[model samples]
Target: MSASCPISRDSESIKKLVDNNIGGVVAKTISITPALVPRPSIAIVDRGLGRFYVLNTVKPGEIRVESTDHLNVRFIYSILNAESWSDISFEHYLEREYPIAIKYCRENNVRFFASIGYKPEELSILGPRVEKIGVDAIEFSTHYIGRDYKPIVDSAKALRESVSIPIFAKISPFTPNISELVRELEKIGVDGIVATNTIGPALSIDVETGLPILGGSYGYGWMSGPALKPLSLAIVAEIARNTKLPVIGVGGIVRGVDVIEYFMVGASAVQLCSIALIEGPGVFKRILSEVEYWLKTHGYSSILDIKGISLKYLKPEPRRTWSTPPVVDEKKCIGCGFCQQVCVYDAVKIDLIGNKRIASIDQTKCYGCGLCTTICPTRAIRFLEQDLFI
Candidate 1:
């Protein structure tokens, strides 16, 4: 957890998350001084519209995981938040926050990780103090650090020198030469990596007033949620393929299938923040139950059974030179004519089979675009070449 999550801000809030059935928690990123956060700091964007929910009036414990029904993916689900670092001072965390987290996490057998910032001076001060407090590990955020990357490497080196426990570098997706960066961190003795912070200083504006929704200067804020999944998946795969260090995936995870996808691409574990902000602490319990049910039903004893399974399937270039058209399964086709609407090449056609309708592809006109295969409501259209997988 980083900015804007109250659960990571203080001991009491942290306890709520601990009570949920989760194995670990990363405290919000703390700094030397509390941040002067802007008002109206958070906004939820759905399908090109911005919504402001009265989350404060509803107590955290009382809030259910209902808003994120299937991860709020029915629309273009995303969050634009201008939140800064932890509002509480670093000294306060040392005195009260860290101790409370450590105690509760200890009682619950949950691993607690302290996420610190990139200031070299601050790292020198905060790293040892939190380490001495007996945190399982330390995660240093590289979010605010610029594109140069030298400062991040330097700070990681200094932090590695200061702490005895594992040091996880939480890297931003925007960082250049990400694979090279993770290798450098590994060389410097950083223990592991957290792939992807939120994507972009993104923007969302109110159509009614023509004003920015978020309160940050110029109303720019980082975006996190379902929209971040595809980009995060590629980056996590890249980092995992590049380094031996355990990679923890964060960004757009709300379902058990999402966790399974991360593991397939090589995530040792995942962090849920954007979903938690909307779903509250109960989100953890809901997601864990889903994951357990899925694992058991799929006949997997553990997540380790599928870890990094997709890596071996990666091909640098296409194996086939020619494009193959998709086949239509007449039995499964509902004949909704939806596929015909999406086929840009005018390749799909609806035919009346007895009293029912079915979709058929004109192989010559298809051009193997594959749009119909994906857009088909039923599992009717598929590539003939994909039969091997079945």
Candidate 2:
């Protein structure tokens, strides 16, 4: 579970996660003084199937809305929220939340991690206190802190000196020179890394009301969900490649295959937020089932069997040769014209073969831009290029 997720908001919600077989829970982030969360804080950007937008050139800088009935053309899932840290005070968590969480987790054999944040002084004060509660670990976030490494390094040092328990730094994606930062944290005795928090100081507006939806200072919030996967995955891979410490992948994990992907890329574990909020607690059980089935069918006995497998194959340079064009599999082609629609080179065409329509490619016209191969709903188009660099 992730900080700021409703499921991690309270002890009761955390129990739901544990009962659903979640390995561990990170309590919502708290600071010495309670944070002021904005009203109408969260808004879901679920632009479901067949919706697309176009830039209206006639009125420069204006966006025009468009729609279609295509079944396979759904957009990504995203959410914008002005959610701040835990509304409850740090003292309240220390006096009430931590003790209860520690007891419950001990009884259930689950690990409890307390997430705390803010300046070095605040972290120095909170660290020893949370450790006294017998938390399995302490995760401090770098949410409002600037991207500069000095402040973070200082905070990590302070927290490290304040407690003897394992400490994890929840990092923001905006931090530059991640490898260098990771090295510094490792030197300072930080035990592990949480590769991401959320991706931005992003904004969302309501065209109807001509005002921002969220009530934060600028209605800005960090982005999370399916769209955040690519960036977060890259960060996880980079961190895992550079450090010996465990990396917990966060952001945009919605399915069992996603967990497999994280493991393959070197993540020791993962955290879920948006999906849990959208689908509720049962998602944990459902995804775990999916992971089990996938592992069994794939001939893998455990997640450890595939961990860090992709790191060995990483290449630093781009391919230099032109590869073969895509090949069409007649059995898989539905002739939906999607390939033809997306092909900029006019290399694909639909032809009536027997009673069915099928897609065919003109090798002469294809520049191997690969638009059709990706757009084909049935994966009918494919490339057989083996080792382009070779």
Candidate 3:
């Protein structure tokens, strides 16, 4: 959440923002009366595009785990790390808002999931409320998953005992060791796990002002966008490798190829945040369409076919096999001596042959990692994989 966003001060604007997000939730989850898009296969967020074109393009998937804002005064105050929520009546506003969203999803025939998040201490109070709301599923998330995460685990276990619906947990990605935490959630039978919540307390600055761009209690705020893709991918990949929990991949996913990459690493599905905010809802159409195109071209029919397929290729270290060395094509070499300077294995040697300065590779010393091939300005080096495999 951006500090300068309208939700901080404007009630109408905040409500409207919430409503749009609800609409996106609906469009993504269920049918809109006349049909919002071509096939209703992709998720078009209500708040992001506010139009039919955007909502119509979501990729077809199941009713995702959803977590609603913990709308109490303290909750709002704390999430933004604001001074207080004195301006908004927590109960009156949420009562007025949540039902309307529920009604919309119900009428639209969408299987909606309601989610809630707050400090772990507030779990007992919110647990009953989560049970009361009539949603298809429940998702529990919190910003506090640091060194002491026992509270989060306890809260999920408590919710599991009472809530009849399928449950999901959204854990923070910042934790150093999440494997054991995931193991505990799996032990208690969490339906799935959203490998992360937004990562931050990150800061973005204006070079001219030498100040932060977002507003918050501190200048720091959470970060979302393609920049987060690597972090999200690592979390999801780690969990997939170690546990059975179904993972919903998120972070910096901006294209159809990214979605496929998430699948290759072992995400059952992916969540869109930055892309939806950046490109609007229409991005779904482009992504899903391209995903379909890629599937067909690759001789695969479903995204599931490629899920975790790349895990087989994952290795802790690169193979150190001796293979063909990068041979400098003397005719093509510009004699820049870039390869000589870059060769970590001390392989490249530049020699003055007759009148011309020429470059050559010492095949004996070249381990075939091929770093020199990429550095060669004249395309004189070839880093072929077949030679490395040999």
- Top TM-score prediction, candidate number: 2
TM-score on alpha carbons, each prediction: 0.86, 0.89, 0.63
Give candidate 1's TM-score. 0.86
Superpose all Cα atoms of candidate 1 onto the true structure and report the RMSD in Å to 1 decimal: 6.5
lDDT of 2 by residue, 1-390 (tens): 444466788888887888888888999888888888989888777665673322122232333433344445646588777877888888888888778877888888888999888789999999998898788899987655565778778889999999999999888877878999999999999999997888778888888997887788888877889888888898999999999999999888888888898889899988888888888888989889888877877889998999999887667875545635788998766667888888888889999999989999898888877778877765679987563335
Ranking by lDDT: 2, 1, 3
Per-residue lDDT of model 1, residues 1-390, tens digit only: 322255577888788888887788888888777888887888888864332221111332232212222332435478878886877788888888889889999999898999888677788788999999889999887556676888789889889988899998887877888889989999999999887788778998899999899888898988888888888899999998999999998888877778889999999989888888888888888888777767777789998999999998766875465657889988667676768988889888898979988888887887876788877655579877563233
lDDT of 1: 0.80
Residue 334 of model 3, lDDT score: 59
Clash counts for all predictions? 0, 0, 13
lDDT of 3: 0.59
TM-score of 2: 0.89
- Clash total of candidate 1: 0
Off by over 4 Å in 1: 1-4, 48-74, 143-146, 319-321, 329-337, 350-357, 376-380, 384-390
Error in Å for residue 235 of model 2? 0.7
Task: Candidate 2: list runs displaced more than 4 Å.
Answer: 1-4, 48-76, 144-147, 321-323, 385-389
